[model samples]
Target: MAEVTAEARIEAPTGKVWERLTDFGSYGEWNATHTNFPDGGPETLAAGSTFTENMKLMGFPAEVLWTIEELEDGRVLAIRGKGPMGVIVGTRYSLAEDGGATKVRIDGEFTGAAVSLMAGKLKDSATAALTESLRKLSGLVA
Candidate 1:
């Protein structure tokens, strides 16, 4: 599996950051890098819940279908995404409490011919994008 993991330290409290991250419906409002969806939010934190969204990666449009596979309230969220071109992506969002801040970690695994072909370059770019996205999000909620 090809993987990319990125982390960011946000000056927001863990609870606040968790709420913003899980508020997938409004992600595009603050994170301009993501495609907007009217009803593209998580229905529930339970496993088996699914969410559909349109996303872009390195200027390529992608339809992301996420299935909630695991959850630990306020701490961890696990999702699996499927897309065209042999794409299978698993992502985990973890939140850790720090002094007056939140340490957020995002880890994703990509399995597909398209992803493997450009893993190294894609990983670096994706990581940077994630960092910036989180930073923007933090600023919005701060």
Candidate 2:
């Protein structure tokens, strides 16, 4: 398995940051791995809601069928997905109000036979991607 986490303190309130985070229409603006939502972003977000996302990671493109696993309005959003080659992916976005700003953290996990072959590289790439994503997200809402 491979795992990565990235955190950033955005100069924006939790509500504002959460709004941008869940705005799947504008996801590509800040999410580094996002290519597009083939059928468009989810119309409503709720546990068990599903969506298809095209993404690029480690220089390879993949389509994932994702299910929303958790939701907490302005506090959290977590999803798990199935990708090519029997790979399973999970991502969690967590937010906390710190002072007057919002502290956002993204945690990602990868598992399955495919991951064993390139766990280290996947970790590095995902870490960088998450960091870049957080930077872009902060810029947009800060």
For this target, which candidate reaches the highest lDDT against the unseen true structure? 2
Q: Which stretches of candidate 2 lie over 4 Å from their true place?
A: none
What lDDT does each candidate get?
0.81, 0.97
Q: Candidate 2 — which pairs collide?
A: none
lDDT of 1 at 80: 96
* Candidate that scores best on TM-score: 2
Candidate 1, position 140, lDDT: 69
The TM-score values for the models, in the order shown, are 0.90, 0.99
Off by over 4 Å in 1: 30-33
**Which consecutive 10 residues in model 2 have the weakest lDDT in total?**
40-49
Write one digit per residue (lDDT tens) for candidate 1, span 28-120.
Answer: 865534786545577776888988877787788878788999899999999898977979978888999999899988887888888878898
lDDT, model 2: 0.97
